[model samples]
Target: MIRIKRAYEEVKESDGFRILIDRLWPRGVSKEKLKIDLWLKEIAPSSELRKSFGHDPNRWEEFQSKYRDELKEKSELLIQIKKLEEKLGNISLIYSAKDEKHDNAVVLLELLNN
Candidate 1:
């Protein structure tokens, strides 16, 4: 199973294989504070795309399309994530976006589902 959680949230015991998928480290969050099992920056959207979207809801559709395209070329990272998913009971993708509905994690979750 795959899950999404805000980076600001406390790392709960229930969260298995917590992974940070953002290309950049979340502002104000210390590495030690984030109990992440993996930091899969390669699986994140490209810097160009991330800057372009800027978390704008209006760019959500475009962002998803572009991100999916990027993922197609990231077979190694995708396979790593898939292996982690199979090894762990559950996988939680942690991100720092304020608008949960308009973030890359949403697209990543969808990709993992398929």
Candidate 2:
């Protein structure tokens, strides 16, 4: 199973194979506190796409489309994530967006589901 979690949330044992998908390290969230298994920077949206979206709600739809395109070019990383999912049996993608429902993790969950 796959899940998404906020970096600010307390780490839980249920969050097996925790992976931080954000391109940048979450500000103020210490490594010791996170205890993630992987940081999949390559699986995140490109720096250019991230700046273009700017986490603007108005651009959420466009952001999803553009980010999906970015992800399509990253099948190698996606395969790795899939392998981890199978091996670990559970996975949680951690992100730092203030708007949880409108974040890259949400988009990634949607993409992975389909």
Candidate 3:
């Protein structure tokens, strides 16, 4: 199973394989505090896209679409992540956005699910 979670949240054992999918390291969060098993920056949206989206809920659909397109170009990373998930059993995709419901991780989780 794949799950999306905020990087600010407390770490739990149930969060089996923790992957950080943001292009940049989260602000106010240290590398050690995040406890991520994998920092898959390559699979994240480009800096331009992320900056333009700016976490605005109004632009969520557009962001998802653009991000989806970006994902299509990262097939190797996607396949690697999928294989790792299969081996890990339970996986948690962690992000640092304040808007947890409409972040890159949410969109990526949707793509992975389908």
Candidate 4:
């Protein structure tokens, strides 16, 4: 199973393989605090796409579309995530966005599940 978690959330054993999917680290979060197993920055949306979306909920639909398009070129990274999930049983995708519902992690979860 794949799960999405906020970078600010407390780490738990049940989180399994924790992967940070953001291009940049979260503000005020330290490496020790986050405790991520992998930082898959390559799977993150491009800087241009990220800045254009700007975490604006109004742009969420468009963001998902554009991000999905970006993901097509990252099949190797996606396969890595799938392999981890197979080995780990549970894989947690971590992100640093304030808006949980509209963040890149949410879109990634959707893509991974489908």
Best-performing candidate as measured by TM-score: 4
* Residue pairs with clashing backbones, model 1: none
| TM-score of each prediction | 0.95, 0.96, 0.95, 0.97
- For model 4, residues 75-113, the per-residue Cα lDDT tens digits are 889889998888879999999999989988998898889
Clashing pairs in 2: none
Give the Cα error of residue 106 in candidate 1, in Å. Answer: 0.3
lDDT of 3 by residue, 29-80 (tens): 9988889899999998999999999999999999999999988999888788
Q: lDDT at 105 for candidate 3?
A: 91
Those runs of model 3 whose alpha carbons end farther than 4 Å from true positions after fitting are none
Top-lDDT structure, candidate number: 4
Let me know the TM-score candidate 4 reaches against the reference structure. Answer: 0.97
lDDT of 2 by residue, 1-114 (tens): 999999999999999999999999999989999998899988888899899999999999999999989888988887888888888899999999999878899989987877
lDDT values, one for every candidate: 0.90, 0.91, 0.90, 0.93
Error of 3 at 92 (Å): 0.7
TM-score of 3: 0.95
Residues 1-114 of candidate 1 have per-residue lDDT tens digits of: 888999999988888889999988899988889987889888889899999999999999999999999999998887888898898879999999999899999998888888
| Cα deviation of 62, candidate 2, in Å | 0.7
Rank the candidate models, highest lDDT first: 4, 2, 1, 3
lDDT winner between candidates 1 and 2:
2
